[model samples]
Target chain A: MEYIIISTGFALALLGLWGILSQKNLIKIILGFTIFNTGINIVMVSIGYVRGKAAPILDVIKPSEAADKIVDPLPQALVLTAIVIGLGVTALMLVYALNLHREKNSLDINSFKDLKW
Target chain B: MIKKILIIGLLAGVGLIFFDLFNAYQGSEVLGKTGRYYAENGADEVGAANLVTAVIVTYRGLDTLGEVTILFLTAAIISFVLKFRREDFIPNRPVRITSELLDSASQVIVPVIFMVGIYIFINGHLTPGGGFQGGAVIASGVLLMIMANPNFGISHKVIAKVESISGIAFVLIGIMGIFLAGGFLDNRLLGLGNLGELFSAGVIPIIYTFIGLKVGAELSNILGTISHAQNEKN
Candidate 1:
């Protein structure tokens, strides 16, 4: 079931990439990037999950001796870091998008052709 | 098309070679058992049930400090991009609203959302939520207010104070860790009390609180700047 979810996420990510590549709308491209980012985060977190296991934090009320039963905390930390970085990047991108809107008066990627050969 | 195929083939070949090299190093003792050892001993030493937090705040705290610096740099860059330096400015006309009910509903919801963000940040160490999550939530609350009440601009002075104070506090906490625990960002300064407790992780919670506030302010400022810029252009 986990593998299936991950695979579907991957598929959606690929679809997002396709959207980014094919779409002319800047908003669509941004949305596509978000979709891709979400997929990657989900896949990473899923890889760290262990069936029937609680999060790595020791249960103070009910301690367990089985190490294998605890889900790895490393990926969660990494994901948290990734999510913050993603927010920063997205904020920067939105700022740039606003600038683009100012200049071109449209949210179309194709319209941003200043550097095209 | 042919070039794309060639590039894909080359990438696959390189990936395979990389995997092979990784496999060769997997069983090698030369890699050392430092990570495993740390993983085993971390919980007891740092008194943090969250091994990842232990590693981040205790074992490799300097790196985390550097990461926070990077966040600071990003915030600086954003501020530079969105700086409002003009001597004279014209405020945009207020957004026209049709429904009094919607405005009243938003006024009620905004404060509740802000409280939720505070709750998330305060209880970060004990739960799945943390500084970043809470910060973003707070920013979203600010964003909600901005959207619902266009005239209700966040006080620039308040945001500036929050951002600067949080940034300073983060650095001071790191320095305190260094002074109290023989290393920068050391988690042992706060007695390393019983694990799973709210105050157990010492500087982790403190660092995270600063991080949350800073992130929240920076994000909301970014959003505000973008919207303001759009309004000006319009």
Candidate 2:
């Protein structure tokens, strides 16, 4: 079941990548990038999962009893970090998009080609 | 069209092979063994039940520092890209608007969001959330305000001061770790006190808080600069 969910996330990510490659609108590209980023983070977090486990916090409960079941907390932490970094990048990209809009008066990427050979 | 289809088919075939190879080696204990090592030893050395946080803030403190530096650099680059000299830039015609409903909504919600961000950052060491996550949340709150009031702008000077102070404090705390604990960003500098306590991670929470503040300010500043530039261009 976990693997199924993870594969679904990966498929979504691939779809997003396809959108990014094929889309003409800059905003669509940015949205695609976001989709891709979220999918990857979900995959990373899922990789650290242990079945039927609670979070890795101490007692509150007995350690010896719960040791066999606690889910790894490390990937959760790493994914949190990744999410923040993704936000920063997305925000930066939005700023760039605004700049592009100002310069070109349009949000279409194909229309703003200045460096084409 | 035919060429595109052929290329995609080739790629799919290659992907299938890779998938098969991965499945063939699946359920092996190679990486799982390493995880088990940390799962066993992490509780003792870090004093935190969450091995992830222990690894992130303590074992990989240097990586965190570097990541913070990257954020700082990004802010710098963004500010540079959108910078306007006082004399050369012309302010665009201001768009007048009146929206009492929007203003009232923002006024009510912004403080709550800000509080939540602070709570997240402060309790990061103890809980799943941390400074980076909280900082971004705070920035989103600021973004909410920005969206609600087009005329309202963050004071550039105040933001600059906040960013610089927080950035400097983050580094200073790291240096304190070095001086006091004999290593840069050493979380054990202040003594890892009783486990699961707020201040137990030594300087980890402190550093994360500073990082949170810095990241929040920088993110807002980036958004502010872009909007300001757009207003100018218009």
Candidate 3:
């Protein structure tokens, strides 16, 4: 399960990277960015996965026994934080895309060559 | 042609690394020391049944604070950059009403959905969910209302009030922790009521309540601004 998850996540990240590097449409690039974010989250989550362990909820078992039974809470906590921040970044990027579209009347990012050296 | 080859080469390098990682990743059979510590002592130390909640709200609290600030600023910037003239705004074209039944059904269902969001956040410490999930759910409920009635609008005043008050309360509670408990954002501000109970986690539920309200308000505010701007541009 862990192997499958991590491999799939890596594949997704690669797909997103390809989209960003190849796609002309700004929106496609943004979609790729989100996919990449999701892939990173999946990898981070699977990294912390311990075989046959439950979630880190103390309600089901005594606190002393929780150490062996529970999966790592640290990665879950960090990933949750990362997901929230990723959403914010994506929203900001989208707004920027909208503004660019308004100014240039084009969604194709390649059309904006002002930065090309 | 060169760009394509270079890209392929880069992708191949990535593929190789992935293959290597995949081959080497033996699933951990033991929790890390910190994970072990949180799992064992979190209930007694933070009094929260959910260790993830304990980690986010109490252990790594300062990080959560910074995260919410990032959300607040992103929301502020989105609205700022996308400001549109209301007088010049063109409303959405009226789509033929698909189902009177669906529209009426939402009236009952939306409130229930909204309540479920509230329940999730309030019981965050004892459950799998926390503030962010609940807030997103509430925002979806508000969004459903928007779709059902094109003219239906949330008062910005109410949103702003809820946002500011909760944000203030969150900060104040963190400050109160300085005096009432150990460090900043400490969960032991009050007595750890009871394990696995509604109010068992001191300050966690309160903090999550504030977070849920603030996040919901921010998301709704973002949606409101975007929809209005799109209408104006169209």
By lDDT, the best candidate is: 3
Error of 1 at B113 (Å): 1.9
lDDT leaderboard ranking: 3, 2, 1
Error of 1 at A90 (Å): 1.4
Best by DockQ: 3
Say which candidate scores most in TM-score.
3
As a whole number from 0 to 100, the lDDT of residue B120 in candidate 2 is 84
lDDT by residue (tens digit), candidate 1, A1-117: 555555655656665666566668887888778777887787666666655565666544233342444555666667766766776677677667766776789998878889999
* Candidate 3 stretches greater than 4 Å from native: B85-87, B90-102
* Model 1 misplaced stretches (Cα beyond 4 Å): A60-66, B1-39, B83-88
lDDT of 2 at B90: 55
Residues B1-234, candidate 1, lDDT per residue (tens digit)? Answer: 885676566555644653453344321221124434444566667776666566655676666566656666676777677666464344764567837776777788878877887777766656666667788888888887777766666676888898899878877877887777867667677787777888876777877788788878877877676666544524
Stretch of 10 with least lDDT, candidate 3 chain B: B89-98
lDDT of 2 at B228: 70
lDDT of 3 by residue, B1-234 (tens): 999999899888987987888788889999998998888789889999999999999999999889889999998999899987777666664555647876887798999999999999998999899999899999989888777766566789999999999998998999999998997999899899889999788999999999999999999888777666666644
Tens digit of lDDT per residue, candidate 2, span A12-111? 6666676676778998999999998887777676677676666766646343443465666567767766776787687778778877887779999888
In candidate 1, list every pair of residues with a backbone clash.
none
**Model 1 accuracy (lDDT, Cα):** 0.67
Q: How many residue pairs clash in each candidate?
A: 0, 0, 0
DockQ of each: 0.28, 0.39, 0.80
The alpha-carbon deviation from the true structure for residue A56 of candidate 2, after best TM-score superposition, in angstroms, is: 2.7
**Chain B, candidate 1: TM-score:** 0.77
